[model samples]
Target: MENDPQAQEEILEELVMALKAGGQSFILGILLTSILWGIATAQIWHYYRVYRDDSKSLKRFVFLLLLFNLAQFITIIYGAYYWLITCRLPGNYPKVLDVTK
Candidate 1:
């Protein structure tokens, strides 16, 4: 059976409404992820500081891990902002999704 454009539009509208409905939850998720990332990075830094004189290689590894985690944190923050903007601004939704199709 062929898909009807009208049905597809209806489905899309419903999906958008659902996303809008969950806007608060999305914000909460973003907040929680950021808080958890901060806590993890803090713990890593604490360990690194405590064991700074343990080994040269271990220090380097911990430094690298911290850098990687920092990069990941930045990426996640950007993604969360993008998601929030996309979901909160319904006017751009069609244009954003249109590019995929």
Candidate 2:
């Protein structure tokens, strides 16, 4: 079964069908997300630079902390996406098997 060409062909066919169904939407979503992420990153950098030169230490510290939090949040979101879509199977299968049978 491990070397079954028919099974491999069937899987490829199914993958093709699935891609045909939602491939465009998937690509568009990633593109939109990337654009928005870029814009957000740029804005964060701009704000950080603007605040970095502030004369008031308190304002600088608060802005730095806020920027750090924003960065961490963005990183968490990216990590989640990576974990969900990249690191695992395309579909959400049960991670554990019921071996009682």
Candidate 3:
């Protein structure tokens, strides 16, 4: 089933586009991204806390935001991919084969 992975990827891409269109899916994406952003920000905070004396290693808010957004983007893509894969069409489900003859 070489095509299965491609089909799943396509479904995920479509799900992302459709979700971006509006409603609950869009809201869910926003919430998930925001949560990721928050977590990334906290990580930055922790790093700063441990390296407060290292001026050269200090992180700027803008840079942290950029990193956080990048992480959020990746998280959203992965979430969409798996969500679509698991929420497949009923007909797409695997059918059991009878081996006994």
Candidate 4:
């Protein structure tokens, strides 16, 4: 495909249109995950404060679980931002998807 600006613009517009439903689903999933992560964070804090005598092994397990959730949450937020903001720019998503095919 030649680097025709009009064709590129058309591709971008088409890509955005195709993404709408999937985008809505992504937003919904992000919202639900965010709420659950928040609640889990709060509960973990409470566990640390109130369960001072929890066996060391159990405390380690809780800490590990929290770490896992934190990592997942960060990735989800980053992915949402990357796809919705960065990739939505005029040139980005088309190249990423190799839309020429």
Candidate 5:
């Protein structure tokens, strides 16, 4: 069957809208993940610098703390990706398009 030009145009518009929404959601997730990762890394680095020349026991504690922060950062990244995948699915047909033809 020959595809009607009007129907093709409507489908294209729907796809474009879905893609734009999904892209926006993905970008938001990336931004949030990056911020959290930066904060965690900075905190760990600060602690390490402060304890670099301290007693051996204190240095060990600082290392452990850094590891904990890294773990938390990983968890945050995983959650962000999960949310993006679930919320940004491209099947959301935009209501703005007039499909009543």
Candidate 6:
């Protein structure tokens, strides 16, 4: 079966479909995250501009929240890239659900 052209073609097509379906969700998530991040940035900017006399503690808290959001966004991008590009490489698939290792 290894040398059968038709079987190989079908297998290749299935693999392509699986990759497309999996990668599409990742792309959509990244896009949505980018939009939300932009909105958050704008809101934070407005907060600082409109409330210039806010307490230092409050400002620090808001800044920390923004940093955390940025971190989450960064991790999402890295995870998607790792799964879609790195794991999809030839021979990179994990064995029997041992993906975390």
TM-score of each: 0.59, 0.43, 0.37, 0.79, 0.45, 0.77
Candidate 6: misplaced stretches above 4 Å?
Answer: 1-14, 93-101
**Which candidate leads in TM-score?**
4
Which ranges in model 5 have alpha carbons more than 4 Å from their true place? 1-5, 53-101
Candidate 1 regions off by >4 Å?
1-18, 21-25, 86-91, 96-101
> Which is the better candidate, 2 or 5, if ranked by lDDT?
5
The best-first sequence of candidates by lDDT reads 4, 6, 1, 5, 3, 2
Better of 4 and 6 by TM-score: 4
Per-residue lDDT of 28-53 in model 5, one digit per residue for the tens? 86687678778867886787777577
* RMSD (Cα, Å) of model 1: 6.2
Q: Provide backbone clash counts, one per model.
A: 0, 0, 0, 0, 0, 0
Tens-digit lDDT track for model 1 on 35-84? Answer: 88788888887987787677888778877887887787788667767766
Clashing pairs in 2: none
Instruction: Give the alpha carbon lDDT tens digit for every residue of 58-90 in model 3.
Output: 456546676768876877767666445543444
RMSD of 6: 4.1
lDDT of each: 0.69, 0.56, 0.58, 0.82, 0.63, 0.80
lDDT by residue (58-92, candidate 4, tens digit) is 99999999999999999998988877777677657
Which candidate wins on lDDT? Answer: 4
Tell me the spans in candidate 2 whose CA falls farther than 4 Å from its real position: 1-11, 53-101
Candidate 5 local distance difference test against the native: 0.63
User: Per-residue CA lDDT of candidate 6, range 10-99, in tens?
Assistant: 555655666676788999999999999999999999999999999999999999999999999999999998887776664543321243
Give per-residue CA lDDT, model 2, range 1-101, as digits (tens): 23577875655555555545555565566577667666766876787678676667766666676677668666756755654355336242222111111
